[model samples]
Target: MKELDEANKKYNSDFVEKVKKTDVGENLKRIKIKKNVYIDSLIQPGFIYYIETGVVLRSFVDAAGNIKAIDILCAQEVMGLRSLIGRVGVQLEIKALEEVTILIIPEKLILANLQDAYHFLCSNFQYTMSIMYLHWQAMLSFGSERINYALIALAYYVGTEKDGEFFFPPYITHDVIASFASVTRSYVSRHVSKLADDDILVNQAKKMKIKDMDTLIKNTPNYQSF
Candidate 1:
């Protein structure tokens, strides 16, 4: 999370301001998406989306037609890099987990307007690598430990923080967490109850919070090894 946070801080926040003064920017489509809405069934070519607020889940369908959650991305993240090369479909799907605002810019426009394109691309690469690293960590874990790591990641990526505690919205149900952890919903519920009993977490009515991060991390085997 530290590395990911640092990369986020390096993103050029001024990109929008610079774009606003240009003619192409005037035609930029910034759309508001409601919670639980699907952004697209298949990847769209020739455009990239800049998340302005809220979170989304990125998933892909396998040959078996089963959808699996691959990543959860939040504000300031840019998606659809493959679209720049005209890559379309591939069974990718994007769905809004929260009310989201996204700025859809043509690929050429992002390249033309983005100052420090190298750093921007690097930052995006860092974010992608971070998620892959987390997936690798989860692969080495098992049972509740896997769930623990998933919760920690979800907290960092999608939860809101206040006074050193992380609060996850009500829509982040056991099923949602189970998908990320590659576990069953019942398994997630059982482990979450154990965490609550230990006072490391608080989950009520589908909403959750990390009440004690140190204790929660202690339960996640090898979580700090990275």
Candidate 2:
């Protein structure tokens, strides 16, 4: 199991396979967190946190003090990476959407534990940035690729599985996805409804199922393929 864990760490880069996934109660030092544990609440004098479950929103306030969300991370994203690297506590708030079991370790301890995972994290930072840049440009592109790529990412990250098909997670309020896709919920909804009308996807139990991958590739919206 130890050897298998290392191989998984090498291939997956998150070391999720290496960590012991004990149930929430089994932890000796359990910290209970309620919803919206203010994104910056996790940062204090000395600790770093790893996600146990639930979503974490990375957000900031404008000069007028209105919150603007910058990123949403579900399971596995390290909270307070900047502080762990070298700095004061993170300026970003990391709120939880539900009860979560965050594994906490002192910043220095985590740095000590990183002897093996450093290579993985350093290389994977490029991957993370590239992904962010792709989504950033997706809506700006004049072609159909933006929407398509966004859907692919959504499916891989948050989609559900049923009856041999993968579907978008349920209760993904139009408002939420709109933020990442860089479109208004109304526009996202109209496009989504159109796909369902054409059977490219289906709204089943309030979830969007990607029923036809080939059709999506063959007939993209506003596409001009030879």
Candidate 3:
């Protein structure tokens, strides 16, 4: 376990070093965010963030007065690119799921300094498209199957493989899952229990594990090809 932890640390360090070598990364300002703190208002126009460590929960209050989790981002991911590109006012509320370190870079600087914007643009586009697809899938799953769709979407966002087993981060709770599913907490709990009973998922001490990846992908609607 200690070896695994060390390997993960080294991997993250190597990734950060690679990012730091980029033109936009060279001039970035690092900011540390405490857990549960709101960061949306801190993001001004023409600025974007790059996650260096920890998790960030992107959520927003809907028209029905309910806060919804739009996405969960971790290290090596970019945030606020959509808002910057659209030149729109900030609408998303970003919260730190844990102690987070991010590098803030001005959009103007990136555009001016980066020789090849294609890679950055492609990365942002792909992430945005995935989130958009998740929203679309959730909308399609509205009535009775929403929970399943939400679980698949959440897995796509934060699930990682360790020793060939897929698991979600320990920080992800029923409430967070509820927000992602846009369902009630009770509903999430019930569905999660059902998944456990069905042997699709296992709620363990520190994480929720997907028992069979092939079975899960096959059973989840609109996720078979994903």
TM-score of candidate 1 relative to the true fold = 0.86
Consecutive 10-residue window with the lowest summed lDDT within model 1: 12-21
Clashes of each: 0, 3, 0
Clashing pairs in 1: none
Q: Kindly list the per-residue Cα lDDT of model 2 for residues 10-96, writing each as its tens digit.
A: 533244333333223333243657775664755655554666667666666556654545566665555555665577532766667
Q: 149 in model 3: Cα distance from truth in Å?
A: 1.9
Tens digits of per-residue lDDT, candidate 3, 159-196, equal 77776567888778888888888888888878778878
Query: Which predicted model would earn the best lDDT?
Result: 1
What order do candidates take by TM-score, descending?
A: 1, 3, 2
Which wins on TM-score, candidate 2 or candidate 3? 3
Candidate achieving higher lDDT, 1 or 3:
1
- Candidate 1 off by > 4 Å: 9-12, 63-66, 86-90
Better of 1 and 2 by lDDT: 1
TM-score on alpha carbons, each prediction: 0.86, 0.67, 0.80
Q: After superposition, how far is residue 72 of candidate 2 from its true place, in Å?
A: 4.0
